[model samples]
Target: MFIKLLLQVVYITVPILIYYALIRNNASLKRYHSILLGIICGISILLCMSFPISFETGYIMDLRTVPWMISFLYGNISTGIILTIIMLGYRIFLGGIGMFVVFIAYSITLLMILFYFKKYSQFSFQHKMKSVLTLTFINSLLIVSSIHFIFGFSESHYLLFYTVFTFMQLLLTWLTVYMIETFRENDRLQLEMQNSEKLYIVGQMAASVAHEIRNPMTVVSGFMQLLYQSDEIPLKHKEHVKIMTVELERAQAIINDYLTLAKPQADKMEKIDVKEQTSLISQTLSSYALMNGVDLHYHIKSDENFYTFGNPEKMQQVLVNMIKNAIEATLNKKAVTISLSKDNEYIYIDITDQGVGLSEDEIKKIGTPFYSTKEKGTGLGLSVSFSIIRAMNGQIMTTSDMGKGTTFTIKLPQY
Candidate 1:
């Protein structure tokens, strides 16, 4: 019985190991992946039930709930339902009065899981372990009680078996949850390291080439401007020079962005009034917004002044970049709103736009160098803004709905 039970555990653990190995580098699961996960859990359930530890006629024990609960908690709702159908169907096929008991117990268990399912993914690791353990205990207790009522134990030996069975179930559940969570954390860290390496390479390249590229561009731009103003040049030729000069200025701006990422200049940190800077940026961008036919609105949500420690100029730059993006995103006659508020520890600046919003995949790629949603965008503006905020010990968070719009919230530690 011990060896058979250990084999059941291997049935569960091996699939998990294989599945995670197959998807170790994936940032998110696809639909087929979820189906594959359901199939994996279902296989574990079927294997455990086929080789359950038998105590008597119509009485058996297996760690099936471990995989079932894992399916519901870690996989999607459809995956959970698929596992349920598979488990109960196989339980019936095994031909036991215990099948009815399991049906009742898991029906209740499914409801409880569904109630907590939405928030389970958001829980901390400790909370998740507690939740899984609690559910496993309840499930084991339910099955034990049902078995006792339906077919009473004939001796103390059966009772001892029940205790050991429950303990084994809890232990396996804990181990499985711990292993999966550890893998998830490790994968997350690996992804962050990969991103950091990419950023480092880009920064190094920028530092090496930005000045070299800028010098020639600046020289060309200066000559173009001279041609634009030269009386000797034909009017049509001067117009072409003007266009060249404008393109050069745009190129210079991009190089400046590269420099911002490559070597951020050290600035003296000062206590910055968040409200003042926000208002100043709103005024500075108001004309630009008007030119785009977008309404720009700014509001201070509290009477108290919000202050944080940062370079005031850089703070304004971040504000301008974020707010300008919002305005550009908004359609003509739509509104872009900026609101300032404070909590106990952080001041919040929210820039919202009434424009077609981003998908989850697109949102994840934001702030990546050279990634942009707009045509003619270099994508360096938001990257520079992110770097600036990080230097000031702040964070930029984004939330969006597909058809509605997007909101960017900048949180800076309060001073």
Candidate 2:
């Protein structure tokens, strides 16, 4: 029985090991991950049910619930339902009164899973382990009780067998959950490392080429300014020069963003008054916002000043970048509001805009270099802003509803 139960453990875990192995380096396969997980769990269910641990009392047991529960908890509702159908269909093919009992027991288990499905994905590792184990215990008890009552198994040895079976079910469930969580954590870390490597490569390229590129651009910009001001030049040519000047300035801004990412300076840290800085940025951008037909509003929820530790200049840059984006996202006559509040740990700066908001996919790509929502944007402003805030040990969070608007929240630890 021990060896058979050990084989059941292998039956339950082998598919998980194989699935992760295949997808470890293939990012494109990640899109079909949940479906793949459902399929693999289904395969495990078939294997476990085929070689179930049978007892002399004509009762059969298997580790099918381990994969079934995992599919529901980790995958979506559709996956869970499909797996349930598969399990029931296979059991009916086997043809026993136990099939009906199995359906009823799993129906109850599925209902319990549905009750906790939404919140289970967000639980901490420990909480997830506890929840899955607790559910498994209840499920095991239900199955054992149903089998005992229906089959009339009154043998003393049958009780001991059930006890061992229940213990093995919980043990195997715990192990499977642990392995899955470990794989997930490792994947997360690998992704973070990949992003960091990309950032480093871009930073190096920017550091090497930005200065060399800036020198000629600066000289050309100076000459363009001279021609724009030259009275001897034809008016049409001067207008062309003015356009060139504007384009040059725009290019310069892009270069500045590259430089910001290229060489992140360790600025002098100081206690910054977030409220005062936010107010200052609002005033500075007021003219620009007015020209865009967007109204700028500020709300202070507390009378007390919110102080945080950071480079004051960098903090202001993040504020200006975020607020400017907010204003641009807002349509003419719409308002962009900046609100400030603080708690014991962190100060929050929320810039909310009233405009056509971003989609979920667009929001995810917000800080990626060279990606932007605007037609002519460089996409480096937010990237630079993100880098600056991270340097100061702060976080930037975004929330948006399509056709409504978006909010960018900057959270900085209070000094």
RMSD of each: 6.7, 6.9
Residue-level lDDT of model 1, residues 1-415, one tens digit each, is: 6687789789899999988877664646532567778888888888888888865444568888999888888888889998899788887887868887898789888999988655575455777888889999999888877778787876775678678888999999999999999988897567557756766777899999998998898789888888788899999998888888888888888888888887554467899999989999899999999999999999988999899998888888889889989999998899999998875667889899999999877887788788899998988999888878878887787878787899898988899
Q: In candidate 2, what are the lDDT values of residues 254-362, reduced to their tens digit? A: 8888888875555588889998999999999999999999999999999997998888888888888889989988988999999998755678888999999997667
**Which stretch of 10 consecutive residues in model 1 shows the poorest summed lDDT?**
24-33
Best by TM-score: 1
What's the distance in Å from true for residue 301, model 2? 18
Name model 1 segments beyond 4 Å from true.
24-31, 56-58, 146-162, 209-257, 263-367, 381-415
TM-score of 1: 0.64
Which of the numbered candidates is closest to the native, going by highest lDDT? 2
- TM values, all candidates: 0.64, 0.63
Candidate 2 clashing pairs, residues 3+ apart or interchain:
none
